[model samples]
Every structure is written in structure tokens, then in C-alpha cells.
Target chain A: AAGVIQSPRHLIKEKRETATLKCYPIPRHDTVYWYQQGPGQDPQFLISFYEKMQSDKGSIPDRFSAQQFSDYHSELNMSSLELGDSALYFCASSLDKGTGGTDTQYFGPGTRLTVL
Target chain B: AQSVTQLDSHVSVSEGTPVLLRCNYSSSYSPSLFWYVQHPNKGLQLLLKYTSAATLVKGINGFEAEFKKSETSFHLTKPSAHMSDAAEYFCVVTPPGYSSASKIIFGSGTRLSIRP
Candidate 1:
């Protein structure tokens, strides 16, 4: 079975640099969610999209922005990155009650972002 | 407001011993709950979920969770522990009024370590 795909499995950048992480949800999945996991921390919900539209927002910082493309892929763009931004970024996808009665998300191998 | 709590920060068990990871949730109404596991450098995997349906949810790899409304608990359990099951487990809760856009909240995560 196809799983979600994430780009730049590992990234290192200096403080104040900019970075972008991309996610490709599983085929036919209409909902995408982004999460961040700090060192030794649980993943935290950042934002989500449905049908190419921003559907929900969580504790995402103002310097961070994300969007889903027409092809159902999503991107998280970060600017003026801080050292605290270092973490594992994960992307998950699920069908919004389309077939499966439940919207259980499938996650991708996360992108590890390290801001120096 | 809704929140999910993982009672333990870490748990250790011997191989073939019973496994249990405690979770508690608070929600004004019936809530959607989930258990996700992540191995080192791996993505999150959905172990099981409770969506106002059956209380007993059987997931892949012999993992199961029971939703007890009276206790407001949804603990993941397995009859026996395996070295391969050593990982981080997260309890999640989706607040009421879920839509394609709602973001799921994750617990602080509990690290499960298995001894040979």
C-alpha cells in the first residue's frame, strides 16, 4: 500500500534562515494534517487542510504558513527560523469519511528540521 | 475544551509480559480518541481509534484499546510485550465539532521500553 511521502528527510539551517517541508498524502486521501515534535516531546498539531483549502489551525506560529496544492500535496514554509524550530515535522493523510467510516490518518516518515 | 493525558512518561516491561499504557481524556461530549505509535526515526502509526462505536478496538499487530466512558479512559493494551514494540505511544483526542478541518490533540507521549 502507498504511504505518505515527505521531502528532505533531514534539514539543517542557521537561525533566521528559511525552510520549507513538503508532504504528499496517500493517494485519494482528501485531508492532510501537519504536526511538529520537539526533542523528546509528543507531536503537536500545527495545521490541516481539506480539499486544497485551509481547514483548521492549531499552535502554528505566525512565522509559519502552510497550504495544500491542487494535487493534494502540502507544504509548510517557515521564515526567520529560530533554534526552537528544530523538531520532527510529520504529515498525515486520511479520507474524510469517504469510504472508511473513520478518518484514521496515515503518517509519513517525518522530516527532521534542525535550526542551528 | 478537550484534552488527552498519557499517565506515564516511560514504561518498562520484560519480553512476554503484559503491556499497558494508560490514557485519559476530558471532553464535554463524546469524543474521538486514538492511539498512535512511533518507532525510532519512524513515522506515527495508527494503532487504534474510538469513534463513538464499539468500545473494543482491535488494531494491527495484536494491539487493542478499550474505550470506557465511565472512566473517561482509552488505554492501549497487549497481552504480551515484544522487543519490536519498544517505542513511543501517544493518546489523541479530537474535540467536539469535528470536520474535515479539525486538528487532533496529542498526549505528551509515553516511551515503552522492552527488556530481553
Candidate 2:
């Protein structure tokens, strides 16, 4: 089975620049999620896209946004990046709504973004 | 609201020794619990999940977790520690009042260290 795929394993940008990350879900899977992991911390949920619609978002700032296309791919956009935004971004995909059942998530290799 | 707490920031175990990572969760409803592992420079990999099916859930790489409702704990265990198991482990819980599509809450994470 194909796992989730993320592009640009590493990225470096300056403050006020825009950063975009892409993700491709597993074949035939819906429900894609984006998370941010800082140094020595847990991954925080950024946003989720399900069935080509924005589903939910965690405690991300307004500079962050996401879009889903055709239910199989998604993009996370960070406008006007800040130093605090530097972190590893992870993309994950699940089969269904994941309603307290066996629907587990598969993750991508993650993209490390650095803001200077 | 839902939250997960990993009791230890780091755990060290010798090779062939048993390993245990403690996790506690707080949720208003029946919680969906999960354990994910992240190797160096890699993505998050799902080790196991609990969703009201079997209280004891078995995952890949000889890992398992038992969901103890009475203690609000879902601790991961391995009969023996392997060198490859040295990584970061995260305990996750889904939001209490929403469907699986809701955003997930992650623990601070526990780093597993294996000694030869």
C-alpha cells in the first residue's frame, strides 16, 4: 500500500516570506491531516481536510491555511512566516472519519522548515 | 476537551529488557487512544490504537497497549527492547465531544533510549 507523500524534505525561508508544503494521501484514502512538531515537543494538529473540505484545525495562528483538492491531495500554506513557525510539518491520512474505531493514520516523511 | 499526558520525558532500557511507556488521558466521552513512534528524521508511525474494541490492542514491531478505563491510562509495553526501538513515542487522544474528524491532542512525548 502506498503511504502518504510529502514534498521538499527540507526548506529554508526568511521572515515575512510565504511557505507552502504539499502532501499526497494514500491511494483511495480520504481525510488528510497536517501537524507541526517543534523541537522536543509533540506534534500539534494544524488542520485537517476531508472529502475536499476543510474539516478542523487546532491552535494554529491566522497566518496558516490549508486547501484540499479531489480528496487525495492537500496543501498547507503559511503566509508571513515567523521565527516561531520553524518546525517539522507532517502530513497524515486515514481511511474514513476515524470515529473511535480501527481507522489509524499513516504519516509521511515530514518536511522540516526553517525560518530565519 | 481531550488531552494526553506522557508520564516520562525519557525512558532508558537495556537490550532484551522489558519496556513500558506510561500515558494518561482526560476526555469527557469515550476516548480514542493511540501510540505513534517517530524515528530520527522520519515521520510519525502508528504503533497502535484503541477504540472500544479490545481493551488490549496489539501493534506492529512487537508493541502493544492496554487501555485501562478505570485509570484513564493507555500504556505501551514491549516484552523486550530492541535497538531499533529507540525513538520518540507520542500518546494521542482525539477530542472528546466530536467525531474522529475532530482535531487530535498529543502528549508532550517520551523519548525511548535503548542501551546495548
Candidate 3:
């Protein structure tokens, strides 16, 4: 079974710089979700998209934006990066049933972002 | 509102001893519960999920969880701990009709340590 794939397994950036992360969800999966895990902390929900449409939003910062393309792939763009933004960024894909009876999210390896 | 709480931050067990990771959840409606394991520098893997089907959900690597509605708890357990089982575990809850803004909620996480 093919799992979710993320680009740039590890990234290093300087303050005020910009970065973009990509996520290719599993085949047939229509929902994509983004999360951030800081050092010694649990993963926090950032944002999510269903069928290329923004379905939900969490604690994502204003400097960050994301969009799902027609190919079902998604990208997260961050600008004016800060040192505090350093963390593990994870992408998850799930089959959206519209209802909540079935929404098992499959996660990718994650990208380790280090803002210097 | 839906939230999950992990009872312990860290748990240590012998290689052949039983393993227990406690989790409790609160949801306004019937919620889908899940247990995910994350190894060092790895993505989150689904250990098991409870979608109001079976109270006892079995997962990979000899892991299982029992959902107790009365206690509002879904605790993960294994008969014998393995050295490779050392990882961080998270409890998550997604309420019904979660297609809207309210997404999944994750617990603080519990780090499991296995001793040889």
C-alpha cells in the first residue's frame, strides 16, 4: 500500500526567509491535513482540505498558507519564518466520508524544519 | 467539543511484562477514537481505531484497546512489551459531523519505554 509522501524530509532556514512543503496523499484519498509538532510537545492541527477545498482550520499562523491542487497534492507555504517555527511538520491523508463514521488518517514521514 | 487526555506522560515496562497506556476522552456526540504510535523521528502510525463498532479493537504488533463507554476511556494494552515498542503514543478523538471547523483533537501523548 502506498503511503503519504512528503518532500524535504529535513529543512533548514534562516529568520525572515520563506519555505514551501509539499505533500502527496495516498491514492484515492481526498482529504489532506497538516500538523505541527514542537519539541517535547504533541502534534497540533494546522489546517485541512477536502477535495481541494479548505474544510477546516486550526491554530495555523497567518504567515502560513496551504492549498490542495487538482492532482490531490497539497502544499504548505510559510513566509517570514521565525525561529519559533522550528518543528516537525506532518501531513496526513484520509478518505473523507463526509460524515465522521470513517476518517482514518494516514500520516507521512514528516518534515523536520529548523529555523536558524 | 471533543478532547482526549492521556493519563501518564511516561511508562516503563520490562520486555516480557504487560504494557498499559491510559487514555480518556470527552465528546459532545459519538466520536471516533484512535491510537497512534510514533517512533523516534518517525511519522505517526495507526495502532488501532474505534468507530463505535467493537468495544475491543485489535491492532498490529499485538496491541489492543478496549473502549469503555461508562468510564469514557479507551486504554491501549499489550500482553508483553517489546524493545521495539518504545515510542510515543497519542490518543485522538473526532466527533461526528467533523467535516466542519472542529477537527480531530489529540492528547498530550505518552512516551513508552521498554527495558530489556
Candidate 4:
């Protein structure tokens, strides 16, 4: 089965720079969720979108924003990056993307972001 | 609110020994629980899920979990450990709801180490 796909498996950036991460969810999966896992820490929920609409928000920084496009793909935009932003970014997809969405989620290999 | 807690941060077992990983959860409503295993540099793979069905759920790779509502625990277990089983495991809980803001809560992961 096809799994979620993420671009820029690895990224490096200097302070104050910006970066964009993309996620292509599994086929027929309409909900996308983003998470961040810092070194020696568990994954933290960032945000999620259902059918191109922002559905939930977690501990995502104010400098970061995300949206799901018409293609059911999503992008996470981070501006003014800081060293603390370095971590593994993961994207997950699920079948349900509407009001009732308790479907199982499938994850993508994470993008390792290293900010200097 | 729904939350999960992993009982241990690390566990080590011999190749032919039994393996156990503990998890406890709290949810105001009926919850959807899941166990996911993640290898280094890989995405989280579904090990098993419990949705208020059978208390004993079997998964791939000879893994299984028993849900105990009285104890509020869902612990993962395997009869024997394999080298390939060394990885990080996460316990997750999603509260049942149709609200768009509902999200999954992840527990601090447990790192399993297999010794030959």
C-alpha cells in the first residue's frame, strides 16, 4: 500500500531563514496531521487539516502555518527559523476528514530539520 | 480530555524472552487506542488498535495487546523478542467525537532493546 510522502527528507537552514515542508497523503486519505519530535522527546502534535480546511491546532509555533490544498496534499510553512526548531517533522494521513474522524492514521517518513 | 502514558522509557529483553511494554490512558469518553512502532529514520507503523471491541487484539509480527478497562491499561506484549523488534513504541489515544478540534494524544515513547 502507498504511504504518505514528504519532501525534503533533510533540511538545513540558518537563523532567521524560512523553510517549507510538503506532505502528500495516502490515496483516498483526506485528513493530514503534522507533528514535531525533538531530540530525546516524544512527538508533539502541531496541526491538522481535514479536506483542505484547518481542523485542529496544537503546540505549533506562531511562526509556523499550514494548509491542505485541493489535491489533498498539504504544506507547512515556517518563517524566521530558530535553532530550537530543529527536530523531526512527521506527516500522517487518515481516511476520515469530516466532522466524525476517528479513522486510523498512516504516517510518512519524517523530515529532519536542522536549524543553525 | 484524553491522554496516554507510557510506563517505561526503555526496556531490554533477551532474544528468546518475553517482551512487555506498558501503557495507561485516561479519557472522558470511549477512546480509540493505538500502538505504533517506529524504527530509526522510519515512519510510525501501526502495531495494533483497540476501539472498544475485543479486549484482546492481535497484530502483525506476533504482537498482541490486552485492553483492561478496569485498570485503564493497554499493554503490548510478545512471546519472544527479535532483533528487528528493537525500536521506539508510542501509545496514542483519540477521544471519540465529531468536533473538528479533536486530536490524538501521544504518550512518551518506550524504546525497546533486544539483546542476542
Using lDDT, give the best candidate's number.
3
Model 1 DockQ class: medium
Native interface contacts kept by each candidate, as a fraction: 0.69, 0.67, 0.62, 0.62
- Cα lDDT of candidate 1 equals 0.90
User: A1-116, model 4: which lDDT tens digit per residue?
Assistant: 89999998999999999999999999888889899989878788899998888988999999999999999999999999999999999999987835455568889998999999
Q: For candidate 3, lDDT tens digit of each residue in A1-116?
A: 99999999999999999999999999888899999999989898899999899989999999999999999999999999999999999999988876332578899999999999
- Residue A100 in model 3: lDDT: 39
Candidate that beats the other on DockQ, 1 or 3, i.e. the better one? 3
- Across A1-116, the per-residue lDDT of candidate 1 in tens digits comes to 99999998999999999999999999999889998989898887899998898888888999999999999999999999999999999999988765553567789999999999
Model 3: how far is A59 from its true place, Å?
A: 0.9
Q: DockQ of candidates 1 onward, in order? A: 0.61, 0.59, 0.65, 0.61
Look at candidate 2 and tell me the lDDT of residue A81.
Answer: 94
Error of 4 at A114 (Å): 0.3
Pairs of residues clashing in candidate 4: none
Indicate the TM-score of model 2. Answer: 0.92
lDDT of 2 by residue, B52-106 (tens): 8899999999999999999999999999999999999999887543445445778
Q: Residues B15-116, candidate 4, lDDT per residue (tens digit)?
A: 989999999999887888889999998889999999888999999899999999999999999999999999999998887644333467888999999999
How good is the docking of model 2, as DockQ? 0.59
**Number of the top-ranking candidate, with TM-score as the measure:** 3
TM-score of each: 0.94, 0.92, 0.97, 0.95
